[model samples]
Every structure is written in C-alpha cells, then in structure tokens.
Target: MSAPETATPTIPDYAGDPNAVLNDTNAVWRHGGPPNYSNTRKNWEIAASFKSFLTDWRTVDPNKYTFVMNGGEPQSAEHMLRSNFYSPLNNDFESSHKTFKRMMPTFAWEVLEVYSGPPKVAFKWRHWGVMKNDYVGYNDKKQKVRVKAHGGPIDIQGVTVATVNGALKVEKLETWFDPLSMFKQVSKDNEVFIDEDSA
Candidate 1:
C-alpha cells in the first residue's frame, strides 16, 4: 500500500497598510520594531503561537518538529532568520486585526483601532528601551494620566519605552540588531537591559 500524501504547511497571506509601514505611525513603534526571528526555536515558537491564534490554521498541530538543543551550538544566521523570524512576522501580519483586539485591553484603548503590523509580544529584545523625551500620558508625574496599549499598562514599571536622549530627544539604543547580530556574538551589554542611553 502507498503512504498517504501529506500536505505541506503553508504560511497565511496578510495585507498591510502602506501608510503605517512607510511612516511608522503604528503604536508598536512606541516600543520599537516588530518581533524578529532571533533563533530557530523562537521562530517556531512564534509561528506556532500565532498559528494557534488564527481561525483557519488552528488545525495544524504537527507531531514532528525541528529544533536545535541544549548545547551552545548554533544554527547559521541566515537559516535562523529564514525559519524563525519570517514565520511569526508573516503570521502576525495576517492576524493584525485579531492581534489588536487581544492587545487593546492591555494598553491605551483610545488610539486608532486598526494596526499596521504585529504586536509588541512579537517585539524582539532590542525594542525595549528607556524614554528620552516626555511622552504625553506616558510620564505619570507630568500628566498623571495612564494609557494602555498592546494589552499592557503603558506607564507601568519596567515596561520599556524610548528613553530620553536629552530633554527633548527620544531615541532607541540597539541592544540588538537583526542583520549583524544574526551571525556574531551577542554583546554582553546587549544581553542586559541596562540604561537606555548607552548605544
């Protein structure tokens, strides 16, 4: 008897708003960039996580999985990006609508309902930063107003924000990068979420 032909796992198609991508108007920019594939497992973790969220792809529960294990040995950067990063990004992009719904209760509920990209849960470690300038409702002392975003309290402790560069400047120091860090050693400083001013 012949074995049954198994179907290949496919990524879902998602559309994005041109303005949000080009201008970076989305709320996620407040934290930093979108979630990225840092390793093979993280990539798959995100893929599986989001796939579970999708109404259509919920049925895909593959028994056989691919991953590297306990040792410090690592996979090639390109391979890591291909397998891990793109998959979750693609999945989130498809379900941005639902993602926003899941996220809205956690953060400031007043901003635009539609989102341009993935949520901060999808944010790579690099996006975490300290605020440089004062953001309205972002700083409690100044405005004393609390707003929520992405299903979390924005003004809460340890919730990373773009830290003040000086008095008026808000900047993000890249503790992590997508392209270069993929292959090289992850800096000790990068590993620790220290003061945001240091780049």
Candidate 2:
C-alpha cells in the first residue's frame, strides 16, 4: 500500500495587517549560559544591552517614527502608569512618567526592541515602563509585572502562534485599535511560543 501524501502546512493567516505594527527584526544576542551570566552581572549586562538597543532604535528609521513596542503607538511608560489602567499616586505618576518619558527617552527610547520569545506573548500592548519597570504587584504589595515567558524551538512559517494574557489591550497604531480582534488574530497565527526543540 502506498503511504498517504503528507500535506505541507501553510502559516496560519492572521486576519490583520502583519505590517500594521506590534513587532521587530531581532536583538544582538540570546540570553543564556551558566558561566556567561551571574545574577548581578546579568542585571547590569542586560541594562547596558537595553540601553544600547534604545540608541540603535532611535537612528534605525528616522524617516518613519520609531514606535516602541507592539503596533508602535506613541504612548510611553509614563502615560501608561498615569492613565486609567493602573492608578499610581499623582506624584508617583508624574515622577515615573518623567523617568520613562524624559530620562529614558534621553537615552533614545526610539531604538528599544522587545526581547524575543514567543512573538505573541512577547509582543504585548502595555507600555515600555510597565514591562520594564515594577508594575505588577508582589506579596500583597506593589511590584513588577510578573509575566510568564517560554523559550526556544519554533517553526517560523505560521502566524497563529502564541497567547499573551493582556496582549490585545495593547494599543494599535493603525486606523483603529481593536484589542479583541488583534489578540484573536495573534492566537490564530501561532505567534506565541515556539518550542526551541522543534527544529
């Protein structure tokens, strides 16, 4: 008996503009290795790396606005904390805003890139400060946002990939922002976690 023909899988079609925003090319290097990183050194190294990324992002495409995060919206870490999303104390809000908007931007927030993982899970709608700073609550007190990230093997062919809990709510830079549809689209595209072992 002849073996049945195996159908090649095509990338799942996401229902929106892949170019409409929410993305990047890649980062300089991957984060890993036992001897390569120590806790203190890793933190410092990552901070330095991120700073470098911000510098590059600013000059990358000057002809076009370099929006930082998914969909490249003009919003910043400061705007997010102060906005109705998370209610920070007015003074804290202003201070945080200044930190992200002014101080951070001074480092050229333009070149900042999202650290890679599952594109969908990694490409969230939240502001940069929320992701980078301490926004998520901790042991009953406020703390950094606790997001779950998985790594490795993935087939780059498809779009309907991964799932991020609050991804949809991220603002879009297009004609309109539809968090629900965008989330759905990403989910269907398989944009989330691609098992690093799946090569």
Candidate 3:
C-alpha cells in the first residue's frame, strides 16, 4: 500500500499576538490514526496555548496557571523574561522581550514526540526563527553584546516536563535547552559592542 500522506504543517499566525509560532503549530503531527497521537496533540497544544508569554491563546485560570522557566531556580513567567533570556542577555523583562523580539521575529516551535502522559507529561520540541535583524543583549558581566544578523534561522530544541492538576492545567512547568547554542550561532564572529556609558 502507498504510504499515507501527511499534511504540511501550518504554524500559528499569532497575528502579532501569539507571544507566539517552527511553532509548526502542527507539533501534534495531525490526527485520525492512533489514540496516543490525539493525546500527544492535546498535550502539545496545551503547552503552546498556555505559555506564560500570553495565555492569550487560551483562557487559563489566573490562580491555577503559571508558566515558569527553570534555569537554576524556578521563577514566575514575568521573572523568566527578566532572567537570563539567552544566558548572555541579563536584562529586565521588557528589555529582554524587546531584544529577543528583534532577534527572532517569527520564532516558531513544534513537538517532536511524547514520552509519557497525564498529570505528568514529557516531550521533545523544536523552535526556529529567521534572523531578520541584529541581536542585542547584555551579558552577565553587565556588558553589552551585539551580533549581526546572519539572515538564517536560529533553531533550537529542548524538552519540557510538566505536571498538571486535576483539571489538566499545568501547575508546575520546567524546560531544559542549551541557550548557549543560540549564542554561539549569532556570535560566530565574536563581535562585541562596547558599553558607551562606561567610557
């Protein structure tokens, strides 16, 4: 029999709002084949929709939901933005968002596969976006770093392990990915922008 055809992935538009998109948004891998695939799709969509950036994608209980990124210590969603967004960039939430926004305008994400299910879920994912502009960031040393745009995609992969409450609302979320890999990509030239204020 001929191989079943798979539909091409269409990422979420976010329409300037997804906080959002490799986001192939299709991470779910389509449906109608297996029950597990459906479950996997549900979990992936739950993650993409309930992200801390903007639960705007889906309505989540204020008291029941929070997206926390774990590096060393767990922190609130807003705090995650303020923390080392890219390890080298140690700026406030707003500043970090602005810097990263300019770096990857269409940073998309998708699910690779699901390892387990229910209350506790584990999965692999991929995020990629084209570098349309330069990347500006602050290192832990409080130094300014700028990398010219390579006009290529800064692709990243990571794993998220989360626990859901009775309602399937993620109560605790944690993700692990190499932020330095992204840094190494944009910093291939090792170009550094001096801190003029220090002069």
Candidate 3 lDDT, 1-199, residue by residue in tens = 9999998844333322232321434333223111222212343343332333343323233455555555555544443323222442456655665687688766666879999886678999897778889887776666666778878778888898877654445566678887567766666677656465631
Which scores higher on lDDT, 2 or 3?
Answer: 3
| Residue-level lDDT tens digits of model 2 in 31-54 | 321122221222212322332233
Which digits, one per residue and each the tens of the lDDT, describe model 1 over residues 1-199?
9999998843322212212222322323222443333322222223333332322221122221122222224321112232211233333343433332243322221111222222211122321222222211111122122112222122311122222211212122111234333212222123212222321
- In model 1, the runs with Cα more than 4 Å from the true position are 14-127, 138-199
RMSD of candidate 1 to true structure, Å: 19.7
The residue pairs found clashing in candidate 3 are 21-108, 22-108, 22-109, 23-108, 23-109
**Order of quality (TM-score):** 3, 2, 1
Query: What lDDT score belongs to each candidate, Candidate 1 first?
Result: 0.25, 0.27, 0.57
Residue-level error in angstroms, candidate 3, position 93: 1.3
In candidate 2, stretches whose alpha carbon ends up further than 4 angstroms from where it belongs are 1-53, 58-60, 66-199
Candidate 1: minimum summed lDDT over ten consecutive residues — where? 134-143
Backbone steric clashes in candidate 2, count: 22
lDDT of 3: 0.57
